[model samples]
Target: MQIPWEERYAFMTKTHIETYELVEECLKINYFGMKYLTEALLPLLESSDSGRVVNISSNAGRLRFLNNEGLVKELDDINNLTLEKLDDLVKSYLKSFKEGALEENGWKLPGGFGTYKASKIFVNAYTRIAAKMYPNLYINCVQPGHTQTEGSSCTGSQTVEEAAKSPVMLALDDSGQTGFFYDHTEITAYY
Candidate 1:
């Protein structure tokens, strides 16, 4: 499948402005979107026998800036742009996910695009932590392989249904593997 990149800022006044606006919108979608999934959707799913919760995250949420455990650099064969800042950001994400509070005063911080990324990162983290906290829940996140969707436009080789396979696979994972990340049928890690 060949999906075109969705033009998120088609109505923008200029190119640079459009780019910024699109990123902003992506951040908002990610933040509130995950919140909704956790608050509204997960409970209902958990009540079912074949309970499953799948979040369609992005490779962008992988946070290449930090290594696992938020320690040293995760960049040997990989890139090493801003591992320190990435660690801090990932820590903030984990903190929020484990606890929940981007702001003490109930507001977003300045330059919160990282927070958006952190929110996605935290979703996967929460998936893991929640699974540990509750033994019977099956929760996972899917990168979805650059699929074409309403927000993403059509900019990938996968269709919505095709990209949807990863989540679907996790949902049907009778083996009970929780907090894993899948890109269709394959299992991949984000840290």
Candidate 2:
């Protein structure tokens, strides 16, 4: 079967999953890992007058990729998006992975980026959810532009210097901005 390069490139990072470990790992680290750490640090963060919770997330996690109207409405409704509900969503996502039906279920364009996107989607959502839960905390998530980090195998276009600025600046900013997503240095919507 001679698949064209264009088609291959389109899906270079995508395909129906034959293994669930990759998705599981992504969820464990990207979403739950952040959640657990933040929970453990809530006391310290609360004690500080200018508490900042900076989650280094990726642009891949944005809500734009989601075409599922119902899902969008649910995640967007922070007041109703409880931790238990979010956990349920994660569980459902994993179920989709096991069934190899992510694309069919309205999660799209992930290609090889499926699991990362899946986990990050939650990261962004949780960032907002937590921020609303704790009004005083300066909780924000930033997409530190694609950088040539070891995690990306040094393949990202932006240099570490460029990427570092956004997160660092957000960390130092005492502007009381919370539950927002950033594209580099600019304040932006979660989508």
Candidate 3:
């Protein structure tokens, strides 16, 4: 049950600042939508013997994508992370974006796409949190490689089917691994 949405504002960069509404919309679709959906279905998933959650994350979600050392450390501290803290971090990012101070505030990425990157970063973090909270379930996030989707302007080398393999593999995995980030089917460092 994969629900997809086109990121029409994927072209937004540091120089081409997007509106607050647009930035928020990106977060809503990329992060909040997934979060709410998973939470809503958690009970059903929990009842299953092999419940699994394979979040379709991106390489852009890597902690290295962030220029802010503090933020990176905060996100990496999964043991102490809370949903409230994550929400606050996102609100701070939104404030920085609204103030036109993303770069100064260390919320901007090198190649831009700050909003999208931040949203994915949050998704990765939320994946970890959920996994920790639900030890009975297998929860992980995977970077499906650069696929030629509308978001990538069809410049990516891989087709949509090629990109689907990693996530689908993770979804069907019965190893009981949780709170991991995968680069294609292999486990990778989140930081």
Candidate 4:
């Protein structure tokens, strides 16, 4: 009946192989998955005058966690940040991860947190760039706030209902404020 603590932590932590697999899967499911889906639906979205994209983002995506001034600028440059460019940024981040140069290259989130944060950051940047591409459509990123959900590792303080409101509100908003970030319920600059 004596179980080692390492046994408990084993699944919580990961191997180098797991990290690489996770990073790639994270990009695929979080960033590229969204990208391809949106592209596939662009025609339908374009046809409707009320098209809206409310991406469920997180506080982890906030620029304050990034800490790299140069990277922040690149991520925030809505005018010049294209879809192709975003892919390049993701590629560079992955390269830095593999080379053990994350801190040297400016990524500071540390492994899984770094990947999730980077994914959301990519989603936020994509929201900005896409909103610019389709001015008529309402596209924005909404931070659902840390809520008591399975995804939050059960560390959240808010209810699932409370967390759902942010994206739902953004989905229904017609204030003409596209390419913006919402901290739960308030409109704010992401950077």
lDDT tens per residue, model 2, 20-69: 88778878988999999999999999999989989999988878777787
Per model, how many backbone clashes are there?
7, 4, 0, 0
Model 3 lDDT, full chain set: 0.87
lDDT of 4 at 82: 92
Off by over 4 Å in 3: 1-17
Question: Relative to the unseen true structure, what is the Cα RMSD of model 3?
Answer: 5.5
TM-score of each: 0.59, 0.88, 0.90, 0.87
| TM-score for candidate 2, residues paired by index | 0.88
Off by over 4 Å in 4: 1-18, 110-112
lDDT: worst 10-residue window of model 1: 69-78
Write candidate 1's Cα lDDT for 12-84 as tens digits: 1122322334544544566445646565866777688877777777665564533343222332212332334
TM-score of 1: 0.59
| Residue-by-residue lDDT tens digits, candidate 4, 3-108 | 3445533543453233777888988898899888888888998899898888877877877678799999989877889989999999988888888888899986
Candidate 2, overall lDDT? 0.83
lDDT of each: 0.55, 0.83, 0.87, 0.82
Cα RMSD, each candidate: 9.1, 4.4, 5.5, 4.8
Task: Give the 10-residue window scoring lowest on summed lDDT in candidate 2.
Answer: 9-18
Model 3, range 64-177, lDDT digits (tens) per residue?
989788989999999999989998988889999889998888898877677888898999999999999999999999999877887776656689999999999998998889
Which pairs clash in model 2? 13-111, 13-112, 14-111, 14-112
Whose TM-score is higher: candidate 3's or candidate 4's? 3
| Candidate 1 residue runs with Cα over 4 Å from true position | 1-28, 67-116
Candidate of highest TM-score: 3
